[model samples]
Target chain A: MTGRDRKLTRFLRIAAFSIGMIFVLLGVLRGEHLEVFAKAVRICLECIGIG
Target chain B: MSGMHRDRVETKDRPGLHERFRLLIQLASAALVNGYAAGFAGCKIFTGTSKMVCLPVLNCYSCPGALGACPIGSLQAVEGGAKHNISFYVLGTLMLFGVLFGRLICGFLCPFGLVQDLLGRIPARKLHVPEKIDKPLRYLKYVILAVLVILLPMLAVNQFGIAPPYFCKYICPAGTLEGGIPHLLMNESLRKTAGALWNWKLGILILVILGSVFVPRFFCRYLCPLGAFYSLFNRFSLFRMDLDKSKCVDCKSCENVCPMAVKVTEHINSPECIRCGKCKAVCPVDAISSRFETDMLTRNVAVKKVD
Candidate 1:
């Protein structure tokens, strides 16, 4: 690959990583993790074919 | 040495130490994530604090021994909740994993993927799916992701304003194998309640089991939404496959061993590649290699020539 292509690829990777981290922080602020936790702690009867 | 002679030599050494190391990692990952032995014995799912975190793979949250939430399940739960909101937490977690490792998780970390890998070891005649059908069928997982995982959970709601996790309730063979069958085996009352839905899930599980026995990584190739999600980041993920065009002799050894049917010579970083290192292990000239993108930036670029 050319030097220009390499630079572009690197830029894209860094941009994606930053975006992912930002979303994670936003999700934490919104307390979505707590929703996930509350749901996961249960037996999830539908998941086990009971529902 | 000629390419043909090198090919024969490498074929004899196929699935060398790389594969063995990968298997060790796969086993360790499967064990570490499902470490709650007490949950299994007591016939209960883990309700520990660790359940708050989402695992990167397709493990069922309802599995008695699971310590963390499955990303897809958590996404569906939040999406189908009374609020019917999208789950930023699960989506962000999945994106983080995807950007970091891509489908490398499918190759090494997923408990369900491990099951399919083990099943592929059975001594049977492997069936080769024709390109005419296989190419299109590979899109089925993405459809399932968009529909069962994202669409149905968001749009289809009951009178109470809650929606069922369509993927888990209707399609997830992993849930049936790891959570449903085990729970049914442990609780007699649960077994008594088994209806057509449970039977349907059981049938899907059997089909997946049988499919894996004949075709390697059948679920990952054609049915795993998690794999499809991870694949989106494969091209830009930190983990990457690099092929040295200068050293390659067009031997096609890597293509033959690839379980995902990735055209490694043409597209070394194809999204379909699971990065199982089978191609790397079988390469006669050590033309195929893997590295993190950070490593590429820091290393002496002049010493490496990759395409």
Candidate 2:
């Protein structure tokens, strides 16, 4: 609520924004590479009597 | 007297199988990954599928016909090369979700987290780490990121004296167990050629999985680089805790319900807080709410009558 607190919150928000961008970038770049992961998921499902 | 007890039993029973449904979702998600592997007879890429979701959990990436890659594995892949450039697309996608969901992924989305939860169900008395020990030890994941994820690959020399994914090779329990184990298990070629390095990775994965059952999310709290990344978004994340001190009775109910041991009052936006909504669920005064960024903070006001 005060100036100092607002500054700190703003700093935290900016920091979070930067970090979030990093994760989103990584996820999109590699989204297509997960064919192997998806395949593994299918096999696991079959083992558990789930289609 | 017995009538009151009967009513309590009726209310506590959940009326049906909500718990069962959650268990089914957890199991089904885990199963799908393993099932994909079984169908392909080995790990193979799916060329036909266009839509892929980066599952919000650690899944065995080596399983065959995997429609999409594990985020951790993909991150390593991007950094494994000499160029050392991160895939902005992947980073953006993960950031979008992290800002929105925070660590709710750990409680509600992660397959591995679910596994740990299920394993903790065993009647063995849980060992608790005192706050003194638990608080500082949570930084281990950041260490893993800086050392295992960033430094190692950046430093390693390759065929032409370049670099490789050191995190994947040395520290990532997720990559070792997820992408490495299942493929190695089913693929005769990989099993025969497996070396001491493989043993080392297996040892680490076992330690991580077993450790998580003892301490809530030991991996997520400590060694999960991905979790470390999401944690950074905890405060400003679209989904996050909002505390109205006006009505907070300060009874510590939310603290008791939190699995990650976050003090709901002392620090509402700790990087370690996963924004799981569990605290909101158990708040007796309904003072804690995970209101989204856009919603006019539609806070649930406590409407109790007082004399």
Candidate 3:
């Protein structure tokens, strides 16, 4: 691959990583982590095929 | 045996140090995620602060010993909630894992993937899926991700404004093996409620077990939504495989030993590649190499500009 192509790929990877971090921050701000915790702590009946 | 088949058998007979190290990593990851042994005795799941986080792998949150939530399940839960919200946390966590390692999680950290790999070692005759069929079947996981994990949970709600985690409820054999069976075995009340859905999941679990024995990574290749999601970032993930064309002898040993059946020589960074390093391990000439993209970037920065 050319240097230009490598640079573009690197840029994209950095962008993706940045976007992911931003989303994680937003999710935390939205209290989605607590929602996840609430759902996970319970016995998910559907997960065990009871629901 | 055919040449490729013979090479595969030889590789199996003499696993390299890399293989042993990978096995150790897989075991450690499995143990770390499912470390609550006391939960199993009490027939209950972990309900600690750890559940606030999502695991990068396909481990079931409902598994008695699981300390963290499964990303896919968490996604579905948020999507299927009464408010119909999307789970940014799960999505971001998955994206981070995909960008960093891609499906290397599948090859090394996923408990279900480890199970399949172990079953594939049963010494029974393995089945080779024809390229025509295998190629089409590979797309099935993407469809499952789209429909069961995403669409159904978002769209199909009940009278109470809640939709089910379609994949975990109806399909995921991992859920059956990790959560369903163990819960039923320990909790008589749960067993009393077991019905057709439980039976269906058990059947799927059986099929997955049999399929894994006959064909390595059967679920990963055609069913795992998590693997499908991670595969999207494989081409540009920080972790990468580089094949030095000058040193390669076209021996096809790497291809033969690849559990994912990736066309390594033609496309070293194919999305299907799990970054397992089997290809690198089996390359007779040391032509194949693995590195993080950051390493290459650092080297390029140090070198004089030639371009």
Candidate 4:
């Protein structure tokens, strides 16, 4: 790839990483960590066809 | 045995060191996720706060020994909750893995994939569904992801004002194998209460297992929504397969060894590629490599040079 193209590719990778990190941070801020914890601790009876 | 038989029985490529190591890692990950507690005596699943984190595999959350939550199950829980909220964390987590490694998780981390791989090792006449049929059938998982996993949970609610995760409730053989069977074996009360739905799920699970013996990764090829979702990100994932055109002689050795049936030479980075690195291992000329690539820019540069 040309020098300019390589520079652009690097920029895009950084952008992708930045965007992904933001989403991850948003998820944590939204209390998703605790929400998942609450759901995970208990086995859903329905999931195993008990319900 | 005739000349035709001799020609057909081309010696299978022995699992190279890389493959052996990959299998070892898969087994280790599977064991780690499925808790190491002694017997199946405890009906209890690990309820540690750490269980909040999602593992990228199709392992069942209800698996009595599971240390982490299945991403798909946790996703459905969030969508099916009374509040009916979209799970940003689950989506973000999935996106993170999808973007970073694409379906390498399917290749190396999924317990169900390991099970399928083992079943395919059984000496039997293997079957390959015709590409005409297989190509169309692959779209089935995308539909399952769209309708059962996402749409149904978001739109359809029962009388209790809660939407059930239709995919987990109605399908998901992994759930039956990892969670239902173990729980039923250990919990007498559960056995006594088993009904038609349980029997139905058991039948599906059995069918899937049987299918795996004949067609490698039947569920992964045709029914795994998690795989389908991850495939969407394969095109842009940081880790990708790169075919060095300068070195390639078009020998098609890489394509011949691919378990996922990817047209390796044509589209080395196809979404269907599990990134198992088998193609790279099998390539005679060392033309294939799996690593981070600036393929998008490379493609664009070939089309129109950036000044």
In candidate 2, stretches whose alpha carbon ends up further than 4 angstroms from where it belongs are A1-51, B1-56, B159-162, B295-307
> Model 3: runs farther than 4 Å from truth?
B1-14, B295-307
Give residue B40's error in model 4 in angstroms.
2.9
Worst 10 residues of 3 chain B by lDDT: B298-307
TM-score of chain B of each: 0.93, 0.79, 0.92, 0.89
Scored by CA lDDT, what does every candidate get?
0.88, 0.60, 0.88, 0.80
CA shift of B8, model 3, Å: 18
- The candidate 2 chain B region of ten consecutive residues with least summed lDDT is B298-307
Each model's TM-score? 0.93, 0.74, 0.92, 0.87
> For candidate 1, lDDT tens digit of each residue in B204-258?
8999999999999999999999999999988878888999999999999999989
Q: Model 4 - which docking category? A: acceptable
Q: lDDT of candidate 2 vs native?
A: 0.60
Candidate 1's error at A37, in angstroms?
A: 1.1
Q: What interface RMSD, in Å and to 1 decimal, does model 4 have?
A: 4.1
Writing each residue's lDDT as its tens digit, candidate 3 over B139-171 gives 999999999999888888888779889999999
Q: Compared to the true structure, candidate 4 yields what TM-score?
A: 0.87
Chain A: TM-score in each model: 0.81, 0.53, 0.88, 0.60
Predicted candidate 1: what Cα RMSD to the true structure?
3.0
lDDT, candidate 2, B1-307, per-residue tens: 6997876665455313434555676677666654554435635434334314454555544445344556665455555544445545445566766766777666666677776667666666566778788877888788877776666655555765344445655666655655566556666776676676777777887898788777766777777777887887776566667777787888897787566788888788778886656666566555776655542133333323110
